[model samples]
Target: MQGEEQWFSRTPGVEARQKIELDMVNSLLTSVAFASDPSRQLALEIIAEQFEQPATIRTHPTPRAQLIEIVRTYARNPDGLRVLVDVVASFDPQSFGTVRLRQLFDEWQAAPSFTDDDWSAFRSALGDVVLPQLTELFHLATRNRRHRPPAHCKTAWHYFVHLTDLNAGADSVPPYMIFLERVAPLLPSSTGQELRMRNHRLASELGLITAVNEIHLHERESLPPQHHTAYLVIQLESDGIDPERYTLSHWYQWDADGWHPERGEDRTVSILEIENEVERLVFDMETNWVEAVETVTLEFILPWELINAPVDWWRKESHSSRPTPLTMDYPVVVRSLERLRTHRWHRAWHVRWQRLNTDPTSVLPYWSKPAGKNYHTLLETDLKSDLRYACLVLSEPPLPDSSGRTEIETALRAGLPVIIWHRRDCGSPDFREAVQQMLAGETLAQLPILARKLRGEALRLDLADRESHIGRHLTMLWDDPERQPEVSRSYGTPEEGIR
Candidate 1:
C-alpha cells in the first residue's frame, strides 16, 4: 500500500485519470438538470452512432430514463465513457442561455493535487471555517447519541471522520478533499473547493505541481447528503357524524427514513379552533425538530371538505404585534386524507408520481371547466386516458355546490398527484395564468417552493383585499405517494369490507 506522501503524488497513472473522467461523467449525467434537458436525447443518439460497433440502445419514454439507459450502456467502456465526458462538457442550454457544464468540467480538471504544504493550508482553512461552528457541528453529528464519537475524537479531524468517514470505520481520518467537501456547507467561510483551488495557485508560485489529478474513491463512500429541512405532518380526521369537529394526529419526518409517530393525546377540536391548535403544533415542531433541522415544511393532511381551508394564511401568535402567515416561515402543502385511507388509487398515485419526476412536461395539468352534473365522469375519463394527466386545475371552488369538489375527487380517484385551484375564484383568467406560470417548468417537485413564493406575495397585500388575489387563495394538493406518514390501519374509514 502507498504511504500518505505517495497518495498525494503529482504524477498519476492513466487508470487514475480514467477514474476521474468516469466520476465526472456520472456526476454530470445523473444531475436532474442534465437528465431532463431536451437536447440530451439527440446528443446521446448521435454519440451512440459514432461508435465503431453498433450500440443498440433501448427506447425509453422520458429523457431522464433515456439518459439513465445511456449511462448504463457506456459507463464501463473506456472509449464510450470518454466520448460522454467530452459531449457533456460542451452542453449549452438554448432556452436558459446557461453554460455551466463546460465551466464545471474545466474546474474539475483545473483543480490541483494536494502537496504537504497545500494540505496544511487546506486544513488551516477548514479550521477557520469549521472551528467556530465546532460545537454546533458536534451536536448535529451526535444527534442520534448511539452514533456519538468516542472520547478520543477530540480534534476537528476526528470529529469529521465520525461525521463523513462512513466505510473507513469509526476512527480513520478522511482525505483533505473529503474533509473540505463534508464541511463546505459549514457556517460563515470560504467554500471547500474554492479553498483547494486557491491553495493550488499559491503552491504553483513556489514551483510545486499542486493540481488534483487522481480521483479518490473514498469521496464516493462519504455520508449521504444532509437533509436540512424536516417535515411536520398534521393529519386532520373529521368526526364521521359532525362536519365541524376533527381528531388531530401529527407526525415528524426527519428525512427519507419515513415518518415517526409522535406520542400525543387524542385531541379533538371544532373547525373554528383548528387554527389555534395548528399554531400549538407548529410550536411543538420548533421546540422539537426545527433547531436541529434548519427549516420545517408543514404538510397538512385534510379531508375533502377542509382541503381548501386557508391553512397557509392562519397566523401564528408570535411576540410581534403583526405576525405573518405560516406560509412566510414554512413551505405549506396539503395532502388528501381521503386518498391516504384508500389503497385502490395508490398504484396510480405511485405510477403518476414516477411519471411526474421522469417526464414532467408530459404530465400537464387537466384544466376543468364548469359542466353538467356528470362532469366528474368526463374528468375521470380525461385523467385516465393515455395522456396520463398527473395534475388537476379546478374551474371553481370545490365546495359542495361548485364543481371543484367533484373535480378534486375525480383527480384523486384517478391518482393525480397534484391539484391546484384558487379557493374562491377558479373561474378567473388571472388564476389560469398563475397556474400556467407555475407549471411552465419541467420540475413538478418544486411546486411547494413556488407555492410558498405565491403565498408570500399574498401576505404582502392588505388583509381585507388579500382574498381578492389568487395568491392568497392558492391551494395545492402536492401529495407524494413515497413520503407518506405512518397512520393507524383502523384510524380512518377503511374500504367497505376490510374491517
Candidate 2:
C-alpha cells in the first residue's frame, strides 16, 4: 500500500487515484478487528470512497459492510456522516447510482440528532454535484420508458417544487407554474404530455381540479435545448411564501408517510354549514343589491386578536407588534379587502366572522355597550346587507355559530361561496381521505408504522388543509354567471387578477 502511494506520487489521474485510494482502504480495513470500534475512522473513509465508485468496478460486500457498520456505529455524529455523504455524492456515476446513494443518505438524514449544519452541508453537496448527475441519469433511465424524448428532460414545474423546498421554507408554491408560463412555447410535445400527466395526478390527489387546468407543458417550447436537460430546478424565495404559515409542509409530510384522517364527518358538516351561511347571506345581499341598485363584495374576518386585546391599549399595543408578520391583522385585513372590493354598480360585503375566547364578559361588554356600539352595529348591518359573496374563514377550534340553520339555508339560497380555512387538527374527513390515498403508495406501505405514525400529525398540528380554499373560491367565481363576464373581460387583458 505504501509503495502504491509512493508510485502514485509521481503521477495522478482517475486510474492512479483509484489504485492509491483502494490500497489505502484495504490496509485500513485490515487493521479494524471489530466493526463497532470508534477508532475505525480510517476504515470508514476507505469504505466511503469505495462506495462512491461505479458499482461494476468497486469491491462488493466487504467494503459495503464496512460502510454500513460505520453508519450503524457512529450514526449519532451527523457531521461525520455528512462529510462521508458529501464525498460519496461527489463521485461520478455510470447509471442510477445516485438513487442508491440517496437511499443511504436519507437514512442518515432521519437521525434525530441531525443538526441544521448537517442539513445545510447535505443540500450544498446535492446541488453542487449530485443533482446535475441525477438529471442526466434520469434522462437515460427513463428514455425508453417514454416513447419519445421529452421536449426537455427537465420537468420545469416539478423541478420548481423541489427548488422551492430547498431554498425557501419547504412548503412554498413551487415555481413550476411560473416557469411553465414562461417556457411553455419552448417545450416539446412529449414533455407537454408528461407535464400534463403529472399535474393531473397532483390535482387529483389534492382535489384542486376546479381551480384551473394544469398548464400545458408544450405550450411554450417547441424544441427544448439538449444542454438544458438538467432535471432539477433550484428556487429560493425571500418573500414568496412561508411553509409553516401556508400549511403546505404539513400536508406533504403526511402524504410522504401514512396516516388516516380523524374528523371526517364533522369537518364535512362544518364546511357544509359554513357554505350554507355564505350562500344565504349572499342571496339576501343580492336581492337587496338588485333592489337598491348597488354592488357588494364579501369579506371574511377573524377577530381573535381584537377580542383579546387589553382594555388599556398602552399595555397591549407593545406586545401586539411582536407576533409573526404573516399573522393576519383581522380588522386591518378585512378593511383592506373591503377597499379592494369596493366599486360601482353593485356593492355587497360580508365578513367570515371569528371571535376570541377571552373573558366573554370583557369582550362582550365592549361589543354590546354604547361606547363601542359602532362595532356591533356595523357587524349587524353588514350581516343583513345584500351581498354578492359571503365567506367564513373558520379556524380549527370553531366557536359556536349562533346563526343556526337559518343562516346556512339563507347562504345556500343566495348562491355565495363559503370559504373555510380550517386547521388540519379539526379532523376533516376530506383531509383523512387524501392522506390515506397518499399513504397507499407501495413504498410508503413498506415503512415501519412508527416511522409513519407522524403522517397525520402535521394536520393535527394545524399545518395543512386538505381542501384548497383559494382554488375552491376561484372555482366558485368561475362558475358564477355574474363573475364569468368579468372573468372573460379580464382573461386576455392586461388587468389580470393576482395569481
Candidate 3:
C-alpha cells in the first residue's frame, strides 16, 4: 500500500496530469515516429544518465514493458542502431553523463510532466534491448580487430555497471561479472581459439594463449595466412585495417615479452625447441598413435600484463616471432589439432561436466584432440547400463559440473572401470580419489587414475619414444586384468601415482 501511495504521489497535478496528452503506453512508437534526432537522442541520453541512480524498490511498477516496447519501436532498424549497446555502454560510470540529462529524467519522474511514465518505461526498455545485444557486440569486439577504437571494453564495463545499477533492485549485483561467467562456459573450443588470437581476458583464463612461440595457427584449409608463424606481427592504431608495419617492428612482441633483454631472448629461444618436440609428436601420433610421440610440455608464456598496460603497447605488439635457438616444450596446437582429426582413439562415452563452464585445460592436455562431447546433450536413450567402455573423469578443481559426479557413480555401479590419465598436476580431488582407490584394492575398477604427467613424466620422457612411453601405456591398458593379475607395464605402480 505504501508503495502504491508513493506511486500515486507521482501523479502531481490532477489537472496538469489530465492535460498531459501523450500516453506512456504508446510514447515510444510516437517518439520514434515523430521526434527529431535531438528529441530522440534526449530520451536515450536521459535514460543513460538515470542509470547512475542507486536502486530502490519501485512504488508503482515502472512501465517497464511499455517503455521497452517504445525502444523497440524506435530501434526497428537495429543495424542503424547497432551502436545502441555501444551508446549505452558509453556512459561515464563516475556520475552518469551530464547534469542536464539526469535532471530532466529526475524532474519528469517526480511530477505531472508530459513524460512522467516515459523515463522509467524507457529505462526498462533500454535494458531489454541492450543486455542481450551486448553479448553479440562483445563477441564481435573480441574477434574483430577493427572494433578496437570505440567498443573499448573499458567503456563497456562502465556502461554495463551503471546500467545494472539503474535497473537492479536494492540487492542486485552488476551484470558484467555475470556476463563474463556466461561467456567463459559458453565458448566452444573454436571460439576460444579465436579469442586467444585477440588476447582476450577470458582466453587467458581458459589458457588459450601461452608464453611460448608467438606462432599463430588459425590457418584453416580454406583461410589464407592470418597466422604469424615466424614473427609476432605489430599493428599500430594509425595503421588501421590490414595492420600497419614499420621496420622489424614485427619483432616488437619479443621486446614486449622481455626479450629486449638478451637474457629474455635466450630463454624464449629455448622454449622454441619444445615446439619441435610437439611437431614430432603430431607426426608420430597421426601416422599411428601406437608409434606416436607425445609432449611432456607444450609451454605457452603468458604476456598478460604487458599487453594491457596501454593501448600504445597493444598497438605496437601484435605478433611475436616463433622461437629462435628453440629447445623442447613449446606447444604446437595447430599441428596437433590437424593430426588429431584423423586419430583412431575413442573418446569417453556419455561425458558429463560437473561445472557450468567446460575447462578445456584438462581436456586438451589429456587428449591429443579435445573432449568435444558434452554430457548435457545426451538423452536417456543414449545412456545404457553394463557398457564395456572406460569412463574418464575430469574433476574440476573447485567443483565438478553438476552431473559429473553422478555419471561417474553410475558407471561404477554398472561394473565399469573408470580409467583416468593421471599426472603431476592431479586435481584438488586427487587426494580423496587416491584414498578411495586404496580402499577399493587392486581391482581394475579401483585403479588410481593414470595421468601421463605423474612425477613430471612428460617433462622427463620424450613422448616420441614409442616402446618405452606409448607402448607401455597401450600394453597396460589393453592387457586383461583377470588373465594378468598384475600388469607389468603399469610403469610406476598405479598406486605410486596416486600420491
Candidate 4:
C-alpha cells in the first residue's frame, strides 16, 4: 500500500503531492467499475482531457502498471496533477461511503490558501457580532468530531485566522466558512444577512478550487436560495357557528422581481363545511397557482375562536389518490385575523418584529407560567415590558374561554408575532422537548418546515400513538407584520368576509 512513496520520491514534481492525495487518486481509480483494459484506458483518456496539454496514454500489459504510467505523466506537470487530485478529491461517494469520502476529501484539500482580500471581506461581516464564543460554538457544531481547537487561539476569530495559515487534517472547508454557517443560525438576523451574498461572490471568485473540489462547503443558508413563492391567504369569519364566511381574499406571489397580487373569490359555508371549504381553496391554489410558483405557503387568517385550528392537517381530495395533509406538500401557518383588522397594536408589533430581526436568539419562544394564581397578570406584564419576547409557547390548548385563550390574546395584544402551542392537553414534557428539537439552531421561519418534519415522523408510528404525538397537536401562529394581506373589506360583518 505504501509502495507509491518510493515511486513518488524518485519522480520530480510528485514530491509536492500529499500522501493522502496519492492514496485518494489510487483509491478512486481502483474503485471505479472497470471491466477491461480498454475501459481503463478510456477512463484515463477522459481524465486527461480535463488538462490543457494533449497527452497519449502508454500501452501497458497490466492495469496497475497503466495507473502508475498515468500518474508518472501527470507528475511532469504539477498543475495537471492538481486537476487530477481535484477529480480524486470529488470522486463519486456512491462507490465510497459518504463519511469516508468526505473525510478523505477534507484531509486532502486542507490547504486553506485564500488571499488577504477574502479574509478582509469575511472579517468585516463578522465584526458586528462579538466573536461568538468560538471554542464553545465550534464544540457545539462539531461535537461528533474528535478534533479540538489548538490551545493558542485566544478567540474564535484567531482560531479561524490560524486555520488559514495551517492545514488542519480534517478540513473540507475553511474554518471561517464553517464558522459562518454555524453562527448564521445563532447570530441576530441583522448580523450576517449580507454575508451570504458576499460568500456567494467569494465562492464564485474561488471557482473550481472552492466550489467543484469542496462540494459541501456552501451549506444552504437562509439567504440567496430564493424561490418563486406564492402566498395563499384565507380569511375566515363565523357568526354563532351557523354560517361561516370563507374568502380567498388575497393571492400574493413573489419572484425575483417582487410581489404582485392576484384576484381571489369569496364563499359562504356552514360550520361543518369550513374545513372542507378551506381545503377547496387550497386545491384551487394548487391547481391554478402552484404550476406558476416554485414554492407555496398557505396562510390561514382566523379569528381568536378558531386560532387553534389544525390547518396544516386539512387535506384536499383527488379522484386519482388518497388525500394527503396540506403540510405534507406546502408550509401552512396560521395568522391572526383580528390582528390584521386593527392598527392599534401595530407599534408593538413593529417593536417586537424589529427586536426579532435584530436578535433572534434573544426573542426565542418565551414560555408562559400556565398555573400560577396571578399567572395571567404576571404574564401580561412580562409581555408588555419586554418587546424582545416576540414568540410565546403556551402550556395548554388555547380553546375559547380557557386561560390559554386569554394568554394568547394577551400575547397578540402585546404584539408577539409568533405563538406555538399543543392544540390539546400540552402539559406533557414531550411537547416541550419536541418544540426544543424543532427549534434547535433553526431560524424562526423554519418552524413550519420543522414541524411538518415532526408530523411526518409521527405518521410512521402506530396509528394509535400517531394522534398522541406532539406533531399532530402542534399549532403555530406565525404572523409576520411585513408580509400581510391587503384587507379590502373591514372586519365588519360575518356575512361580508375580509376581502
Candidate 5:
C-alpha cells in the first residue's frame, strides 16, 4: 500500500523511487523464472515507468548495474530487450553521466576473459536471445563512443584493431569494414593505402579472412599527371558482374595541401561500367576533346553495381512520374534530347556532309516531319567555324536531372573557367553561398574564374621557389619546354567535346 501510494503521488524522492524500482525488478525476475506472462508484461511496464523518471530519482551503481544486467541478459527476449533498449536509448550521456554505463559495458565486453565458460555463456546468450538486437546495440555503443572523442593520438583504427583482436569470434567485420571503405577514398592516397593494408594484415592474422577481400582496392587508375603537356587518365575498375551498368563517379584530386579533395575539380567525361548480356563487364568511358591533346579517363570497376538496377528503375519511376512505357523522360534521355536540340543546326548541315562522307539519316531526328522546314536551320547558319574558346556555363542547379553541374565541375578541374549566370529561384541558400565563395576565392568555387586567376597569377610570379613549394613546381613546369613531352604523354587521346 505504501509503494502503491508513492507510485500514485505527484512527486517521490530518490529513496522511495529506488525501493519501488528494485521491488519491481525483483518481481519481474521472479515472474520470468516462473513463466508468468501477465506479471512479465506488468514488470516491463513498471521498468519503463521507472526509466521515465528524472535521473536524480535513481542513484549511480544500483540503477546502472541493474540496467546493464537487463541489457546483457534479456537483450535476446523481444519484449524484455525492447524495455532495456528503451531505457538506454532515453539516456543522454551528456545530461546523465554515462560513466557507470560505459564501465559496465567495458566489463561485459571483457567478461569472456574471466573464464572460458563465461565467453561461451555470452556467445550462447547472444546467439540465442540477443543476436537480433546486436546491430542496434552496436550502433548505440558506437554513437556513445563518438560523443566523447577518444584521447589524443588515438585513431578510430586503434579502437577497431583492439576490439577485433580482443573479441576474435565477434562478427565485427561487416560494419567495421564498411566504415573504413566509405572514408578510404577521402583519405590521402598514402594514408588510405596504409590503413587498408593494415586492416588486411590484421584480418589475415586473426583468421578473419572473409573480410580481407573487402579491404582490397577494386578500382585502379593508370598513373598520376606529369606536367603541363599531359594529364593522367586514371582507369578505375571493379569486379562487379556487369561493370557498364554502374555510373562512374567524378574523379577527385587532392588539393594544394595534399589532404582534402579539390572542389570543382572534375572531368567532363562520364565513366560507366556497362554490363551487356554478351560482355560481362564493359567499361564505357566517355569524354569529349575540344582542345586538349590528351585527357585522363579513369575507369572504375566495382565489385558491386554502384547503382542497383532495380533501385534505378524505381528511381526513374518516382522522379519522372511517367507510366512505365513512357519513362523515356528520364534525365539521361532528357540530356540526350537537350544535346540534340542544342546541336540541331550542326547536325542538319553535318547531315549533308555526312551523307557524302558517311550517314545522313542521323540528321532527320531534328526536323519536324510534318513541317517542311527544319526546326534548327537558323542555328546552323549562325555557327562560327573558327571559335577557339568554349564557354562552360552554369545557369541552374546541378540537380541529377541536369548533368550541367557535373559538366561544369569537370571543366573547372581541367583548368577551365566557367561562366555562371545566377538563377535565384533554381537553387537553395547553400548553393548561393557556394557561388559567393567561388567568386571571393575563399573556397574553390569549382568555377573557372578561380582557375584563371590562379593560373594568371602564377604566370606573373617568379618561380625560383620551385623545389621547395609544390605551387612553384607546377608553375615551373608550366613554363618549362623540356617537360612538354612528359606532360603530353600524360594526356590521354583527345575526343570530341560533349555538346
Candidate 6:
C-alpha cells in the first residue's frame, strides 16, 4: 500500500487491449430474454478489463482459476485491491473477495502492525466506505485481545483519533458518540470522557441542552439502506390542556458536511424558535437521542454558531433555513442593587413602574430578561417576544421578595440601572429629593400644604382640562416678573394662605 506510489507512476503495456462501450456492455447484461452463452463469456472478460492492467488475461483451464489469477494479480496494488473488492461486493455480498477483505480487517484489528506513512494510501484505498464502516471498526476495537494501550494498535489508534476529529465541532450529530457509548466500558476512563465531551459540546449547541421528559424512537419499517431514516417520538415541556403531546418526527443524515436536515424529512426548526416556542411544532426533535437536555433559553446556541465561525446563526438568524434575524424586544432596564434587599425593592418598583408606564416604548425597553425567567410567561412565545410589566403598590417596609432582590442584584452586575422611586410611607423622601429645587430658588416643593392643595385641584379637573390647571399652578408657584409680588399673590389664594 505504501510503495504503490512508485509503480502507479509508470505506464504498463496495452498491446492486446480491445475498445469496449460500457453502454453496450450494460445492454448485454440487461437483455435477459436474449441471454446466451457468448454474452456470459463477454461479461466475465469485461469484468477482467476493470483489473487487468497489462491487457493479458492468463489462460486457465478453469474459469474459477482464471478469476483467482486476476485477484492474485490485483492484490499486489492496494488501489486495485480496494476497487476490485468493491466490484466483487456489487456482484455478490458473500463473494470470496469480500470475505477475504473482512478477514484482513479482522486480522488487523485483532493485532495490528505499525508502519511508516501512517497508512495514508490504505486509508485512501478505503475511501468513503471507511465512514459507514466506522461502527463496525469501533466494535472490532472493543475486542482487544492484546494487553496494551489502544494507541499501540493501528485500528484503535487511527479510529480513536478519527472518531474524535469527526465529532469535534460538527454541527450535525455524528455517529461517533454512538460508537463511543457502545465501547465506553472497554476504553480508558480519560479517553472515554474526552470523546463524550466532544460529542456533548456539539449536542448542547442545537438547543438539545434540555432535560428529556420522555422520548420514543421506534423504527416502523426498514427502508432502503441509502435512505438511512429513523422516527423519533419526543415529549418536550408542553403547556396545554391535554397530557398527550406529540412532536414531529426528526430524520437526520450525517455526511462529510455537518448534520443536514433531510429536506422534507427534517422539519426546519430554529434555535430561536425552540427557546421561545418550546411547546411549538418546530423544536429540537433530536432531544430523543442527544444527551443532557436542559431548559431551553434564547441564549442557548447551535453548533454552527460556536466560536470562530464564519457566521453565527445563534446570534443573527432564526435557523439555517430561515435567515431572518431574531429581533428581540426592547430591554427592561433595572438598577444595580448594593444590598440583597434591593432586588426585592427593585422588583416592587418594577411592578409599579411598568403598570404606570403602560405605553409600549417604556414597557418594552432596549434590553430584557432571558427566555426562561420569573418574568417570561410566554413559554411558547417567539424568542423575539417579551414579557409585560407588573406593578407593586406597597405602603411600607418589606418592599419586594427574595427573587426580586436577586433580580436587582443581577441587573446591577450586568451594568443596567434600575430606577427606584422610593417615597417613604410618611411621604418624607417625596420632598427630600426636591432640595435641589430649593437650591435653585424653586423653594416651594417643601411646602406640603401648597403641594396638596395644588394636587387636589388638578385631580378635580377633567383629563382634557388638566393642562390649563397645570399652567395656572405653574403661574402661582413663582410670581410673574412683569407684575408686582402683591398683585400675583392676590390673584392666587390657596385656602386663604397658599394655592
**Number of the predicted model whose TM-score against the real structure is largest:** 1
The CA root-mean-square deviation of candidate 5, after full C-alpha superposition on the true structure, stands at 22.7
Candidate 2 C-alpha lDDT tens digits along 260-335: 1111011112322333333343343334324221112222221221111111111112335542211111111111
Badly placed stretches (over 4 Å) of model 3 are 1-74, 78-80, 83-157, 160-162, 165-383, 387-456, 462-468, 471-499
| Alpha-carbon TM-score of each model against the true structure | 0.54, 0.20, 0.21, 0.51, 0.23, 0.21
What's the residue-level lDDT of 451 in candidate 4?
73
lDDT of candidate 3 over 205-267, digit per residue (tens): 445333211212221212122222111211111111222211111111111111221111111
Which candidate would rank higher by lDDT, 2 or 3? Answer: 2
Kindly list the per-residue Cα lDDT of model 6 for residues 67-167, writing each as its tens digit.
44444455445455445434444444554334444333332221222122223322332222324344444533222111122221234334543343233
lDDT of each: 0.63, 0.28, 0.27, 0.62, 0.30, 0.30
Model 5 residue 449 lDDT? Answer: 34
Model 4 lDDT per residue over 374-406, tens place: 888889898898766778888688887888888
Highest lDDT: which candidate? 1
**In candidate 6, which residue ranges exceed 4 Å CA deviation?**
1-44, 48-55, 61-68, 94-113, 116-499
Ranking by TM-score: 1, 4, 5, 6, 3, 2
On a 0 to 1 TM-score scale, where does candidate 4 land against the true structure? 0.51
Off by over 4 Å in 5: 1-69, 72-74, 77-90, 95-97, 106-162, 165-392, 395-421, 425-499
**CA shift of 462, model 5, Å:** 33
Better of 2 and 4 by lDDT: 4
